[model samples]
Structure formats: C-alpha cells, structure tokens
Target: MYILKKNEKFNIDNETITFREIRDKLTEEFTELVKAIVNYSYDKTLKNLKAVVREAFDVIQVCILILRKCHTISKDLDYPD
Candidate 1:
C-alpha cells in the first residue's frame, strides 16, 4: 500500500509509525480475520464470504507492510529456510 510505497510520508497520531503501532494494527487485523472466519463458518453466505475476504486482505496487507519495513533489519538476521 501507500505506506510501503511512501513510508516516509505516513504518520500516526502526528508521529512516525513504529513497530509497536504496526504490531498493534497487525493484532487487531488478525482478530478481525478470526471473527470473520468464525462468522463464515456458521453462515456460509455471500456476505460472510466477502467479509472473510476483506479481513484476510487486511491481514495480508499489514503483513506485507511489516515485511517491507523489516528489510532494514533483515540484514542483521539469518534465515535458513
């Protein structure tokens, strides 16, 4: 998203976005995804499908943002997989 494309321009509460903010956002998005999944499991309606898709995308987008922001620290870590 725009944050990944222009992270320098993004701000939250008049402050730069931080890992804590990202973590909080990720947690909230994931919780919404779980709620959507649970609702879909019982309803199985088109509306529920759309909700699930939307929530999933939200979770994925936040994850992508995290990955994009983590590039700076990736060099300091080791990956065997």
Candidate 2:
C-alpha cells in the first residue's frame, strides 16, 4: 500500500525486496493470523478478534505488494502478462 511507502520502517522496500523475502514475510504474517484465530476461538474477546483482523490485513497487504513487485520482475523474466 502507499501508506507502507510513507512509513520508512515498513518492510515493503522495492529496492531490496525479493520474491523469497516477501514470501517469507507472508508466511510469518499468516502464522500470526492463525495464532490470533486460535486465541479468539478459546477466549472470544473483542481484543483478540481485533488482532485477527489486523493480522489478516497485514497478510493481504503483503500479498498485494508481492503481486505488484512480481509483475515488474516477471516482465524482466519475459513472462507473459
């Protein structure tokens, strides 16, 4: 997202990012999401549920970033659009 660009600390750095790095980050976010869901299932608290939403958003954002970056890299590799 554009907001990620604005935040220097965010991990979505195009210059240094690679497919492997993004995929690893995605896996980490997904793990957190699963943990949040497991906690929510047992606790059913609003805060725990909110964590699930937050982690889900993180996963989605990383996936979108990966797609955008991959589109550029794929072109260089001569992959069809």
lDDT of each: 0.74, 0.79
lDDT per residue, candidate 1, 1-81, as tens digits? 444444442333312457889898889889999999999999999999999999888888778777766774676679622
Please list all clashing residue pairs in model 1, or write none if there are none: none
The worst-scoring run of ten residues by lDDT in candidate 2 lies at 2-11
Off by over 4 Å in 2: 1-12, 77-81
For all predicted structures, in order, the TM-scores are: 0.71, 0.79
lDDT of 1: 0.74
Give candidate 1's TM-score: 0.71
